[model samples]
Target: MALDIIAALVYGIITIIGGIIGYINASSNISLVSASICGLLLIFAAFARLQGQTWGLTLAAIVTAVLLVVFAFRLAKTRKFMPAGLMTILGMLTLAVMIHQFMALRR
Candidate 1:
């Protein structure tokens, strides 16, 4: 749970930073708008997890886990060791945390 919260917070912060950068550098409004939305959603998801919304967190974790697995596998097959390893570790950690939370909620 702590790990999930921390990861979400980190992700939110990164997204918000990216959004600010996009707004400053991009002439088109669409990129900035999309970044802002992404930032907001990341923050909202973080807060939801903090509040013990197991269902939402589980869904998000599952999707992210699948994406991470696919990314890792592709990278590994291409011999991109660093990124592949990092993604695999991150995906497994997130999946484990979310699954634990989900099981606890079910009980």
Candidate 2:
């Protein structure tokens, strides 16, 4: 699979798992629902990207960016290096990879 696909998949899986964890640990339905939606969007984007669709990368970038910002805020508010911090870091890396892949796609 392409690096873009891999990155998206990894990020999606991680997000989904985090949601599941949140649901299990704290019964946060919002977290589970939001993460599931975001993760599924990423997964769908991966398939679209596999078919050479620009919108796929665009969607992936947007979703990742949103998640990154949310996590960053959560991290800042909590000042704890745990779920929020970890997610923020992952989101940053995933978004970076998606951006690089998008540039390559343009070229």
Candidate 3:
């Protein structure tokens, strides 16, 4: 749980940083728009997680899973454990949330 929280914070910070850099260096409107949206989403998600809401956790887990799947494959050649571990945990959390949500819906 602590690792997940730290990872979420790091991811949010990096997203905001990248968005600012893109806004400053990007020449096209589309690029700026996309970066801004991404940055805002990251910030919002971070705050939501901090609030300890289930929805926030779900969103964070989903994002983490996608990131892990995309980057883990490239990093797998280096035999790194961080990405793989994060992915596995995130996937489990997401699955748990989905199941809970489904059960609630059925009720």
Candidate 4:
């Protein structure tokens, strides 16, 4: 459970860093702004989970699943071991850990 919480925080921080980089590279793009907002939400969700909020984990699960699909598509199209591939792999591992923790809670 502690590991899951830490992973969730790492996930959120990585996403925010990516968004900041993207925004710096493309200042005029609306998408970067949207991405940054989503990243901020992820950070909030992580904090919420840290405070024992059940909805936080649920929200993180949904966000990570979406990110996994996006990264998977990018990896498939490029067919290389790039950032997309790396993130996709991490997202899968994190998602698995999250699911296992949730299952334990149910029992």
The best candidate in terms of TM-score:
2
In lDDT terms, how accurate is model 3? Answer: 0.54
- The sequence of per-residue lDDT tens digits that candidate 1 reaches over residues 1-107 is 56666665564465456556656776647646654665466567668878877655755565556546665776769776544565466556666776776676679
lDDT string for model 4 (1-107, tens) is 47677777788778767666756776736546655665666667778888899788888888888888987997999887655788799889889978987897799
Q: Look at candidate 4 and give me any clashing residue pairs.
A: none
Over the stretch 17-77, how does candidate 2's per-residue lDDT look in tens digits? 9999999999999999999999999999988988978798889889999999999999999
Ranking by TM-score: 2, 4, 1, 3
* Angstrom error at residue 37, model 4: 2.8
Report the C-alpha displacement of residue 73, candidate 4, in angstroms: 0.6
Prediction RMSDs, each to the true structure: 5.0, 0.9, 7.3, 2.1
The alpha-carbon root-mean-square deviation between model 2 and the true structure, to one decimal in Å, is 0.9
Q: Estimate each model's TM-score.
A: 0.58, 0.95, 0.47, 0.83
Q: Candidate 3: which pairs clash? A: none
lDDT of 1: 0.61
Cα misplacement distance, residue 58 of candidate 1 (Å) = 2.5
Arranged by lDDT, best first: 2, 4, 1, 3
The local distance difference test score of each candidate is 0.61, 0.90, 0.54, 0.77
Model 2 error, position 76 (Å): 0.1
Give Cα distance to truth, residue 13, candidate 3, Å. 2.3
